[model samples]
Target chain A: MSRHTIALAQINPALGDLERNLAVHEKTAEEAIARGARLVVFPELSLTGYFLKDIVSSVALPLTSPFLGRLRDLSRRIDLIVGLVEETPERLFYNAAIYLSLGEIIHVHRKVYLPTYGIFDEQRYLAEGGRIRTFRSGIGRSAILICEDMWHPSAACVASLDGMDVLISPSSSPGRGGLEEGKTFANARAWETINRAYAQLFTCYVLYANRVGYEDGACFWGGSEVIAPSGDTVAKAEYVSEAILVADIDHAEVRRARMANPLLRDERIDVTLQELERIKREGAR
Target chain B: MIDLSLNCDLLRRVLIGFIVNEVRKAGFSRVVVGLSGGVDSSLSAFLGAEALGAENVWALLMPYRTSSPESQEHAELVVKQLGIQSDVIEITPMVDAYFERFPEADQVRRGNKMARERMTILFDHSAKLKALVLGTSNKTELLLGYGTLYGDMASAINPLGDLYKTQVRQLARHMGVPEAIVQKAPSADLWAGQTDEGELGFTYEQVDQILYLMVDRRYELSDLLEAGFDERFVRAAFAKVQASQYKRRLPLIAKVSSRTIDRDFRYPRDWGK
Candidate 1:
């Protein structure tokens, strides 16, 4: 198992200032690198302010846009992930995660689930994405999911299907009443099934980062967490400050844990997969 | 002299990080700052990028004929270092032709004419681009009534009105803002050879420090002078922030009944809810 330090930037970006955000990323990435981090991550919609007034339409960029290009240039040697708005010509705005390594975008994940209740009008601005997949890089196996994707069991199930060793969920969650406890609860809720079922039954890691700030009216509580194989939060960033949470994974533990259970071999997918496919096709139509 | 050491490196960075997140929550993905090649607009652009990502921020360089190339160069440098997109639009024709009808105006009037014209172009692009206009005026400017009411002072949102002049400079550094912008003499660039300190007969460092200690820091005038600030500068700065208190506030409309427009019944930028 190779050593890698994952650094999370719990930053509060201003509304609609692309230049300043980029500079902050550059500076912070340097700091993370100095701290010996090989992987760096930012919260959901870190590029454009989350609310994104009308500017969302104009500032929205395609993959080839200068914005991602700059990030691509910066991602050399550092495995980096960022949450941003990706404009698709099909009249769809994807809540996307661009996974970068060695200065190239290895894989991009579009959010499978879009939240539309209370303070989230995602359906109005973003197009829903299907087909949850994971990327197998040379070093480790990982999967990407935005904030709302963690809310469902199917997301982790889909990622496990791809044999992901770890799942990274970047988020921008509002901070209101009982902020820290609420975020901790949300992280546990999203991770319990994956960490306990998958980590114990199949064995894997769960990584997540939520943004922090007093946005228009609602504040984003930044309480990022890293859940280990035993379903315990091994490490976590504080709730309301800009800080990084770095953690290491012992790959040997993964092989040891999975072999002890051999649960993947006992899976019965025929009935369940067919039924899920039927639901998926019907929902898409 | 103003004391800006209160906004220390860590405190300033945290405050900046927090506000950037605040603006992000306000339903704006991008900001289009009118870079007049002046201190106020430059600071606004820098802060906007910190609040949003550099990719989501845009800067519009609206220059008039009298606008100096030196200032334009500075504006370009600020945008380039921050990695923001910028466009230079010359507003000379629009201003000159419109003002040709009222040729008997003085330099101040002509300068104001250019200022208003520049704002018009800014808002037009803002509408087309769907960006929130980021205001750049500092607290000292807001207080002393140095800015045009709706012209220079207008913005969909402003992040700097809370900071006095000296604090703005200190923040500029923590932001890793280009030194050229932080060190340059303040200027509105409305006309050639015009400097903000020279025109106002007081430097920003003096006025801002004075305003901060007097207002934000809540120091007495005698204390400020005792602390080595010139008596005249302290008095003028305090009076300005006090006299222009009206400009800093939302417009007050007479209420015959229960609620007034912007005072009691404000929830969001849009009243749809």
Candidate 2:
């Protein structure tokens, strides 16, 4: 059984201030390292704060940019998962999360789902990513999912079927519609439900690192957490405030949950692929 | 008698952060606020200072000759307390020049002229200082169209637009604004002794509650009346809200083209990005 200590850096980032945000990233990484965390996850667009319209291009960094080099320097002793606005040589932009280990970028996951609805306009400024998959990481086989990507159930299915042990969801979900009712953070409430469902269904460790702080009237409710394979929260952070939440995750729990309930073993991928193709043909009509 | 509880401490921190991000997002560090010493303007100034620092926020006191002395003094108290740079621009001379040509102008005409004239001063300073104008109209006033169009309503951005007048006072007091300013009767100070509640024939406390039910909660007119609100008050407030719907929207386009600006050629307000 493998054990990994993960840290979720749920901190406020100033918009368009790369230097200051980098300093914050460095500091948080150091703290995570001190706590013996094998991996630290950051929220969506952690390098260049969210809600960048035209400024997205201005803050876009290639993986080879000096900023990644700086992050690579910080990843020498501990693995890091941070979000950045990535620019290709073709000059297109993508909302991507880069995985760093052993002083190098190990994997890059471009967000497949670009949310364009209410309060989110990522599609207008960023190109859609082509795929989602599981990759071998310093923390074992894991998968990276950006803010809106996790909303699509199929994305998580692909990761789980590809044998991902841990699923990392870095997000900047805004707090909405709590001024008059039940939960103070309705968005966070939905997130908890969805994340727990993902953990229980996929029989894998789920780590969500969401940002804290208000940006242009849209408040990012942090509440970053780690959910066990049995769908119970292991650790949680404060809402609307910066917090470094750490939790110990065991791969043994995944083995135990999957052994007890063989949900994945029952998945008929050949049938799913055939039906998906048929749906693609008939969906337009 | 409406329960309008607000977490001012949490609201303040988030709003301050909102102001800073909104102002910076627009590529401007400085903001120009027309401080009338009222709770709305005071709260805006306080949040602006907290967001962009006291040095970046500029407060302008544009008062007509008929404007009360208390208004100017209270506005000055905010400027001093926030330590923001300020200038007092007297609009009497500019407004009187036009009014002298038509001495038969009524209070409404003169008041509208003063409001527009004050906006002119704020916009001119915005150009000179390279700052965006911070709006001060509260949700209660905005719903009833109590403010002069293209006057106090014109701004680059408004933080208090979502907050009701009663909530503004709550935040002002929470932010430790001068008690003299927060406790005063709500007034636009457009004319001599022209209080907002007095002119509207209803207190903000009453209207805010009704509007909260009617608008925020989306309760129908019959629902409000059934909820035991006074019929006359409900009808009057609801009628004003219905009548003033035009003020809340952008100027109507005639739709001469297949793609019209603000209609078919629609995009978010921050589409400049």
Candidate 3:
């Protein structure tokens, strides 16, 4: 499927209300399927809303959860990448994203970075994820990064090196700072820059799905977008509202961009690893 | 002065979304706001009327006997302009009835009593009408603790809580609030000839600048002084913010268990909604 339609489900999940959010997911996924989309992506914590605080334990679901089973069934019609709070048998909670295809969970990426600064308290309630890997999906070879994880370049670098053709970011970022040019938020503009830079540098399609609506007093600005490997935004959603943005992406473009730039091809991973090791050893002294 | 200007156009959409989404999430479609004819309350009323249709918004004009007649007039102006449902309930009788027993009650005491009385009426109406009380306190008053605890400070949600007084004026003008209310000197109007700046002993313009630096930007006292801010004024402004911290928080509950409310039992207010 070189050329396929993808949908960004930019929804506002009700805080701690899983049933209502599931209903929203079902409705949005049905619409995406009806629109001839092969895959639909939701924002971080799409199943359980962001700012879960002490209620994280109550909303945390094991991999065997029927909630996820419903999404897995929905994926039989259209592939899904949904964010949720994952609970291990050991009872540790993580901010996780699951890729469902063919009625099976294809890949699960536990968010490696837990932001604990300024309005974010994820570190206080959840354990840190320690893995970053790319996996095969219905679209192409893809990697998942939760909100704060994408802020770190090393995470995206690892995904690119691991041979990801598409970098999907699910974010529940709050709108802050000030408005830029009387329209977009400064923070939202910053995210756009980051997404475009990663798409151009990695020569991969960037699929950014951000949530909208108010949680407590913080408003999550949903400017979900799809950027091509050439650093061009193919489709963008409106801010502070729910939207299902759809865009047709061709893997041939990723091949063409990579052939033209060839930056990822010349990357020296051995040199980077050696330098990082040397720095760690020297700093230990 | 530091430019506290905001993009009122963008801010209007964000705040309107907040009012509409939050009220619906809390399972209500109607909201009641106590219209004081001041910029903050009037701006909130305008947003509420625009967010949830004017018919869903209820404006209550609760004026004390000593409140300026223009205050009532401006509040009525908002009601008529928005075509919202409104009722004028004079707080004079309720206030005077309580002060009758305590003849020696000072002006501050009387003012506090009136504020709490209005809160009582607002809450009572909230229950009767099944509407949420929209708060009108701005960031300047919240940071300076320039409001009565459990009085005008009480609300189910506050759309103006994050905006400073200067920003509130900018938004008020953008939202087409009457120029008279927007330009009027801000006053609690608990008594005659009383203004907020007069009681604070400084202009909101100066204090808002200081607060923007001290609180929002996290500027050190030394940095503020080096920025040419008067040392005395900066210190006093910081002190007021520190001293009034309690009014901005919920009542303290002494912890007796493993997980106490607010300390560890921290579920969001929108829990399960």
Off by over 4 Å in 2: A12-24, A61-67, A88-92, A181-183, A213-217, A256-285, B1-5, B20-37, B45-65, B68-94, B116-134, B143-145, B154-157, B169-185, B192-273
Cα lDDT tens digits for candidate 1, A12-33: 7655566777787777778888
lDDT, candidate 3, B1-273, per-residue tens: 676778778888899999998899889999999999999999999999999999999999999879999999999999999999999999989899988999999998999998999999999999988899999999999999999999999999999998889889999999999999999999999989999999999999999999988877889999999999999999888899999999998899998999998998898988877
lDDT of 2 by residue, A58-115 (tens): 7899889987788898888889898899999999899999999889898899999999
- Per-candidate DockQ values are 0.05, 0.16, 0.63
Could you give the CAPRI-style class of model 1? incorrect
> Among all windows of ten consecutive residues in candidate 1 chain B, which has the lowest summed lDDT?
B264-273
Residues A81-187 of candidate 3: C-alpha lDDT, one tens digit per residue: 99899999999999999999989998999999999998898899999999999999999999999999999999999999999999999999999866623646778
Give per-residue lDDT, candidate 2, residue A93. Answer: 96
Find the candidate with the highest DockQ and give its number.
3
- Give RMSD to native, each candidate: 15.8, 5.4, 1.4
lDDT of 1 by residue, B72-162 (tens): 8888988888899888888888888988998888888888877777677778877887777777878778878888776888877777776
Give the Cα RMSD of candidate 1.
Answer: 15.8
Model 3, runs deviating above 4 Å: A180-183
Tally clashing residue pairs in candidate 1.
22
What would the per-residue lDDT of candidate 2 be over residues B7-61, giving only the tens digit for each residue? 6666676677677767776889999999998899999999899889999999999
